[model samples]
Target: MSCCHAASWLSCARLVQRADALRIIRRVPMPGYDVSFLITAQHLAGPGARQQLVDWLVGFVMECDAEINGLKLDINARGRAVATSLLRSLAF
Candidate 1:
């Protein structure tokens, strides 16, 4: 599930946790619910910057065998840009 808003993202996670708890009560085997978040700067300007960033992100995720649940991009009035990614993975 991809959420454009932070509130929705958090609520979605809560719902998953609740389902997991219900499964536990019924003694059903539950899969790992591990989740990770990555936040980093996104270059807002310069030629080919966006393409380069997308390539890097795709490569990194593929190499780690990670699943992306959500992505958020924000730019402030001061021209600062940020990217946030929600990743899900099996518990180690």
Candidate 2:
């Protein structure tokens, strides 16, 4: 998790291990658990931008939850299908 503040970002940026990993994270286009959003004061200057940020965050969370649930269901279904097939192939 990120503190989501500039000072915290700076301090974390200073850390050696994190800094190295961060360099890779930046260079590579891969998803990571820790995220940093650099929002400037001007971003909140207008009510529209602020609302958009909130809406986008809400969607982000919802989409993550939905994707996770879908993956779990798919895994369970595949496992059950395999078990059923194995059972049918064997003598009762």
What do the candidate models score in CA lDDT, each in turn?
0.40, 0.54
lDDT, candidate 1, equals 0.40
**C-alpha displacement of 25 in model 2, angstroms?**
12
The sequence of per-residue lDDT tens digits that candidate 1 reaches over residues 1-92 is 23345545665555445434322212322355243323234352558855655655454446334223322222342233222222223333
- Write one digit per residue (lDDT tens) for candidate 2, span 20-75: 42232233334664544445666567768677656655654564466567667878
lDDT at 50, model 2: 72
Clashing pairs in 1: none
In model 2, how many backbone clashes occur? 0
Error of 1 at 79 (Å): 52
